[model samples]
Target: MTIELLAPAAAEAPTRFVERHGRRIAYRETGSGTPLILCLRFRGVLDSWDPAFLDALAAEFRVITFDYSGLGQSGGAASYRAEVMARDAIDLADALGIESFAVGGWSLGGMAAQVVTAMVPERVTHLVLIGTTPPGRVEHPSEAAFLEHALKPVNDLADEEILFFEPASASSRAAAAASNARIAARSADRSPPIAPETYLALLQDRHAEDLFPDAGGYRDFLANCGIPILVIAGDHEIVFPTPNWFALNRVWKSLHLMVLPQMGHGPQHQAPEFVADLIKSFVRTRQRADVAA
Candidate 1:
């Protein structure tokens, strides 16, 4: 059976749904190769991803993006906790009959990706973490402005610059504008923005524990998992500092880190094609080595 590939552009891909454990999970897919499931950041929906980034990645792999259960277009009980969110990704993959695939996440979604990798390391071929921190201890904390802008009911370009881009750099600011415009291009059949109340409750619950907790031996699992992991980050990430990932250098067996200069949290948005190319190289390179072994 030939599966239809959706348009690579985030604006053009049609949303699809699947039943998983009594919940209807919403997802979108493009390209055709090894399946790649991407988890979203805080308050992110399927539309939050930059179209250019998705388009570029579609050239090399089957890219899948989805909303967490009960959030965005999905239907079920919503939980922002990493474990619950991780299950959503795994369940969606299972529902789609994907046996082995790569997993990528951004910010909050990155945390969930780590959980997913830990839970089923045998099935995950590779792990890509973008603009997010690692488990256990962190070297640097997030900026105060991040939460301030993130919690707002509506975010203008200025707010987005502070939240996702490097407002101090003129080039980064330009990228922010372009990314926002691409995100806005999907005007029809768009997923609704996450409600403020839901996000606010998430924040309240998060305060009770560490952002990236070492629960269930996460750090040890990551350190020994042997999965080819790629971490992409900006030099000056305000939300999750790049230094946090650096703090764990050489700790994981097969971890590769790429820090983009003069960028912020959303490096993929700032350099969509570049990031996609990097990902393609990373995944293919590791897969070749695995086959040779």
Candidate 2:
């Protein structure tokens, strides 16, 4: 099926905001049932989410994509710390009156989601970490020169290719094209660009060796957090390779790991239909278990 077939018209929902801690957190909610809050990657606006992926997930879940404070249309100060960003996510959910939900964070946001599950363990019932690295020490950091170029403001398809897909593969390049097209489908109600200072802070913060307090202890926390987790990434990810996540040793009865072939940093976009199916199946199985319990 095509992206248009899955996305339909529901993914174009208007932007909304919630006031929290003297800041306005902008967000858009799509679909219904089982709230899943998705945090964006560095320098990403809410408009950057893959439409096909969002629309597919929305069919079975209420997927929410939001901007961090001081980024996109959101108001307030911006910081590089994942813990601070995690608080922003929690606050926005509270403002929305969502008591319990799943949390999905990509890249920088994934580091924050780690704290979110630990900070308010009961609030987030499930977790999804995509193309993300653990806080503190990065065992397999992306190639420095490649990352330096990828961070530059995207001006064309070439930039998108660097940011999301592997550099030397024909299939990966095609997936990048398809992903970009889906994101461009919505021409109106787009979120504003990231502030210059905010983007800079994020860039600097992203490079920091340690963003989470006691990053060393994070692994122990997730190992026993009692919350189900799904870690999805492309095997060829240049930003944060799949092995970085595997190296975490996040062995648990409830954890699910997926490494897609010939894909890069953005597996969700590279294989939206397949990734969406994996997500839906994972969530539904958990829900059924809860019911059975």
TM-score of 2: 0.89
Candidate 2 lDDT over 156-262, as tens digits, reads 67777776777678888898898888888788889877765667766676565543345537766676666788889887787776776665554544567888888
Per-residue lDDT tens digits of candidate 1, residues 1-293?
Answer: 99974555667889999998999999999888889999999999999999899889999889999999989999998888889999999999999999999999999999999999999888999999999988877768889999888889999999989888889999999999999999998878889998999988876776644678787788877876778889999988999999887757777767899999989989999999999999999999885123211
Whole-model lDDT values for every prediction: 0.89, 0.78
Top TM-score prediction, candidate number:
1
Enumerate residue pairs that collide in model 2: none
Q: Estimate each model's TM-score.
A: 0.95, 0.89
